[model samples]
Target: MSTTGAAPGLSKAFYAIIAGVGGGTGRAVALRFARTYPVALLARGEASYADVVAEITRNGGEAVGVRADVSDEKSLAAALEVVKGKFQGKGLAVGVFNVSSPVSIKPFLETKLKDLDQSLAANARGLYNFAHATLPSLVESVSANPPYPPTLLVTGATAALRGSAGFGVFAAGKFAVRALSQSLAREFGPQGVHVAHVVVDGVIEGPRTKGYIVEGVEDGKLNPAAIAESYWHLHTQHRSAFTHELDLRPYAEKF
Candidate 1:
């Protein structure tokens, strides 16, 4: 993504919503978007989003952190209500589904059925609820003529494309997210919404990945800030040239 200035005269009434927010990629994304629009960060608990929210606010950006569990429809709906209350008459400029379920890597024979169920419930079903909750607002934003297209972005992983050994459950869920994102893109692009799936193929450089070591390669991990920049670029792309899918990885990483 180029070093573009802050979005051109965006509708101040519009806000960006990010689900599955935490200290890593989620915090980076929230801060990036808050530069141009009020941002709402959602997580299952306050601890996941409080610091990020405070940081955004301290930087003179509008931010609200809401507790929400996307896996539960009721919880998601209530969170949307909070968003509505915050934005009032405004529409949704961007919606990011970054929810990642806990994945337990184990041999197929050792993996419990519940592991697969947990992955599916959080990744697939959570995104389903998020899409339903945000799409209407995104479609409404189109007519409002915001500075950029209303975008729905899903954060994917290498598992989204390949089910590697010991990662069956994770792959199943990520693959489902990719599929749904594509379907939404096709269905909503003509309606002026940009639905894109982003594959974060390598270990992200953050606290969570601190122990992930690649000998002799200091830059082998993807930076969350850089990923957020890419996401911003996707949101700002013109409708005439929308990207439905994108992948991010470290240059040192092999395919």
Candidate 2:
């Protein structure tokens, strides 16, 4: 990996990893964190993270894109092994779980079990696998005394807090992820790993959301870059001031 323009004072011996590197928040977060640490981008396909990797490299930051399905234990484990090889002796400074399952919006009667299963696999099981793969390295980094606290950030959604009529399955999965994140925070915070969950409660501004209209509210969609910045804040926070959860939404968004 090329470590051309790494942020000043940030240790090159520690790296960040972001899962679910697509064209949205995942890409933005990966780019933002790459400024501080060589990043490992994980996704189910190369097409999802290839452009982001190139963009990072072009900006003189080091990045590697590894195709792995977080919902699959073996796939994620193998991906981590690849990351280990790439970074050599580095430890994990930050880990972001940005994977979200496809939205299944239908009435409860129409929702199939498969939909619930898929969501569970992607949101809950994926995070489980990702945490298992990265937390050990994050813990080990504590002794290395990096510039900032080692962190694990999980991206959640409005569904994580409440279940809408058409969002039961998705909510179930998100809720499970939130619960797990909370548990992890309690268990790992004392170990020097900052585990936090972000509740993204509005439509995010991105290519996939360009056609989405929020009536007369200008700049109604949440900015992925802003979200990434918030994540960086979370990672940099002192252990004594650790934030276990954060909720982000557009100004006009209702609670």
Candidate 3:
């Protein structure tokens, strides 16, 4: 998205910029990419970034931790710079994971406009800025690798589409995120950039999800790692059959 700084091995391997890297989904995605490509992990907290980088590095994956708050445009812009810097600052990179976490766990009626605004900032505005920041890197992609343009994976929830009485605002924000992804898919897909949304049909089970859900992980609950695999599939799938949206839930999850 911003000026790519020079870094070795950074530009050659696939470049993945993951926002909210401190969260469960960011961690999973970072680990998934670290296996084969260099990854930049973005989050508001520096400690989480350190932990994620250490985890990935310990596991033998290349990763760098960046401190950035998606809610702030300037912060997000810097994170994109980190991506380019990894490649020795010359070439473009592929992939962006815009996984935002809900700021609070409140019922629909009890939810405040401020909370909804926060979600929009993190989920929608954040996506916009990140996409904008990475556009240059995506556009300058090398033909040899034929990298995907800003392949963005937006995390969505069942309530985003189904809608619950107390989830109107959250659902509204997610709905907007879904729409943005679709718009980008149509506008950017033909250009070699892929945009997608994942409707996590049921609850996501992890430490980040513990206090946010009514029930904890069940026997048949979806695994975060497996969900990461889905992203991998979408990332590598031939541009022809690119799935713009996917629904993933456990077998026990109701349609």
Query: For each candidate, C-alpha RMSD in Å?
Result: 2.2, 3.3, 5.2
User: Estimated TM-score per prediction?
Assistant: 0.96, 0.96, 0.85
Query: TM-score of model 3 relative to the true fold?
Result: 0.85
Q: What is the lDDT of candidate 2?
A: 0.91
Clashes of each: 0, 0, 11
lDDT of each: 0.90, 0.91, 0.69
- Quick one: ranking by lDDT, best first? 2, 1, 3
Q: Please give the lDDT score for candidate 3.
A: 0.69
lDDT of 3 by residue, 1-255 (tens): 221222233234456677776656667777876665678888788987788899888886777788888768888777766666775644445455555646355676687778878778877787777777766566556343543334667777775676666666677778777888788888877877667888887666678556553334344566778888887777666666778999898876668
Model 1 reaches what TM-score against the true structure? 0.96
- Show model 2 residue runs off by greater than 4 Å: 1-10
Q: Which candidate comes out best when scored by lDDT?
A: 2
Superposed by TM-score, candidate 2 places the C-alpha of residue 138 at a distance from the truth, in angstroms, of: 0.6
Candidate 2: lDDT of 89? 90
lDDT of 1 by residue, 1-255 (tens): 212346754347789999989967898999899998999999999999999999988998898999999999999999889889988998789999999997678888998899999999999999999999899999998888787889999999999999999999989999999999999999999998999999998888878778687545988888899999999999988788888899999988888
